[model samples]
Target: MNYEFTTVGALIGLAVAIILIIKKLQPAYSLILGALIGGIIGSGSLVTTVNTMVSGGEGMISSVLRIMTSGILAGTLIKTGAAEKIAEVIVEKLGEKRALAAISLATMIICAVGVFIDISVITVAPIALAIGKKSGYHKEALLLAMIGGGKAGNIISPNPNTIAVSEAFKVDLTSLMMKNFIPAICAVVVTILLSTMLSKKQGVQVTENDLEQKEDKNLPSFIQAVAGPVVVVILLALRPVASIVIDPLIALPVGGVVCALACGQIKNIREYAEFGLGKVVGVSVLLIGTGTIAGIIKASALQYDVVHILKMANMPAFLLAPIAGILMAGATASTTAGATIGAQTFAGTLIKSGVSALSAGAMVHAGATVIDSLPHGSFFHATGGAAGLEIKERMKLIPYEMCVGLTSTVVAVMTYVI
Candidate 1:
């Protein structure tokens, strides 16, 4: 076990990226610049750095763009008033009884349909706002409910992160799903409970004037509106089934198109698609930047260094995956990266410690999701845009996720104990 620190240059580049982000520099620029600096230190050639960054960006964006069709579906839901109708129906069903639970339930279900949390927020926030205005509840609490619910699904879901992890671990999708599905249900229940507790403890301010106004947009009947997003989610949930695999890349567009035509949005379908594309711009930029960073880190000595430390560290087998995942994902502001890269980096050490691949994968899933929405993260920006709130403005939601993320670890551990 060769235990050596990461190169000083790699460390410095990371610090610079964080400092720039702290100063409110765009994450795309921060990550790109950080990658360049790290490359210069590791490769010592400008041409080599550019080549690596370009290659890395190309690879990452292929995945990002493939998934971005979901963003279009999400945006259409918001613009067509489908999303608002969905929220209204859910709230109506709950009827001012356990309002928090209603918001949370809606959030979890909407977000579980394999869309990014950023897409989830941008799509659902209008309805959440509408729901909030109809009730006497604090808009902030409602907003947090929207975010927390998506997060629960995001952590262990039909989302891209789960797919990404499944690919990374090489576990049969069904086996992995069976291992995680029950814990995921528990996580959502806990999410609603925690959301209620924190909402009561804090006084949060919200600008809800827009939410209070009547929506004049032409909309579908509530049942018709529900069908589109629901189908999208159901298709995604079936991905692991051996007899059938629903490709979200295909499902989202199909679902989005059906909803657009069904909901009287065809007249402005182009506009809605454009709006959805625009929402993903920042997210795409960030993914490209993260690609560069991931590339630089992999191209350098850091990979070996990370594995060495994991091998030598005095940590319990059950705790290592989540801790490693949290740190990596927090740094990159990407749940996929944290789970994928961190798991692979530590794979050998974990197997050597008598941990099953499936158990380790479960831990990886839990760990990566905890701190995934730092300011640089796509979810932070998208939610900010939809909620009409800034990063600093909605930070009260972060602690709740941190707590939820910790519970994910407990879920992972229970898989072992049971």
Candidate 2:
């Protein structure tokens, strides 16, 4: 009876949470609320509900601290002007007249660095806006290019998100990237060409408004900009080396602070310490909240069963991964979540059903890239808000984005299949 009740209630809670998330409610809050309610109803006891709430609160608080640290680190980078300096250096070397092309390059670079899309966006979007405005190009074009770069690059890089998915599904990131490289590269190329052509056809005029959006001049020293974050990244990549001596998580914040100091941006060591704590709290809360939802579903055994059902459907890897991602993107308006989960869920089935690891991986990549072009995506909203892009109004790039992703996936499938 308890099993039946827990299973039934979890399904209900999941549905409620999904609907609320789709309706633009905060997912973390909605999920916890749904879980609490379900727990109470399923257990039919207030004491059990209270106990769960207390534990959940502790977990959420811890996770939120993590998120806040990453956020502050990001915020400080923006405030200290180091992030701007890096973007400026890259843009200057790349040539502003080719801003869209430049964006493609930046995207590839960031992706290869293995940054999560959420963090990557916070790091890159402002820079993309600054560059596009300087180049007198439509922000829309540049932003789309940025998304294209990050989404496809995610597929090719050993980013933690994909690494998590890989671990969850028992896939190897190195092998996956190796197999998926061609399609990912081809997608970036095609995306760049299309963006450039679209920028031309739109015949968008750069007015005075564009010039006003240039980045601030209080940029950090070039060396500070270069060394700060790069060191942390290298540390993460060299996990085998770092893990032999120190914990990677400890190393990341420590490295961030070291870079912050090297950049001469740290006012005090305590401040950096506090900032890291904040990020840990915030990110951990969100992730753990998500993990809780996952836990409840797992406890009920419904989520796994549902996954098996989808797997046994025996759909083509190229089609199923992207389609699932599209549905998730539409629901959550977040390609990060959509693509991450979609890849995890589909990877096993896709591989078992005869899809090469690389081909299947590309399908996941294609889904994220295409869905993000939709006007409803968080990237679209955030970029448009920050950049003031009004080229042919909102969501004008959807059709074009869809075509690019679809075509790119087809190419990826062929490359892997043959």
Number of the top lDDT candidate:
1
Query: C-alpha displacement of 153 in model 2, angstroms?
Result: 4.5
- The digit string of per-residue lDDT tens for model 2 on 1-418 reads 1232265666676567667765767766766666566665554355655455455345333323333444434444545556556656666787877777677767665555434444455566666766665666675577667766666676665444444344434444445555556766777787788878777666444455544455447666878765646665565545344444332334345555665786676775456556545534433444445544443443443434554666699743346666755654454455544454455445655676676665566566556556654443455665555456563554776676676666656666677557
The TM-scores, one per candidate, come to: 0.80, 0.70
lDDT of 1: 0.66
Model 1 alpha-carbon miss at residue 188, Å: 2.6
Q: For this target, which candidate reaches the highest TM-score against the unseen true structure?
A: 1
Give lDDT per model, in order.
0.66, 0.56
Cα deviation of 8 in candidate 2 (Å)?
8.9
Ten contiguous residues minimizing lDDT sum, candidate 1 = 1-10
Q: Which stretches in model 1 have alpha-carbon errors above 4 Å?
A: 1-7, 43-48, 122-136, 156-180, 205-211, 233-239, 242-246, 264-267, 316-320, 333-362, 375-393, 416-418
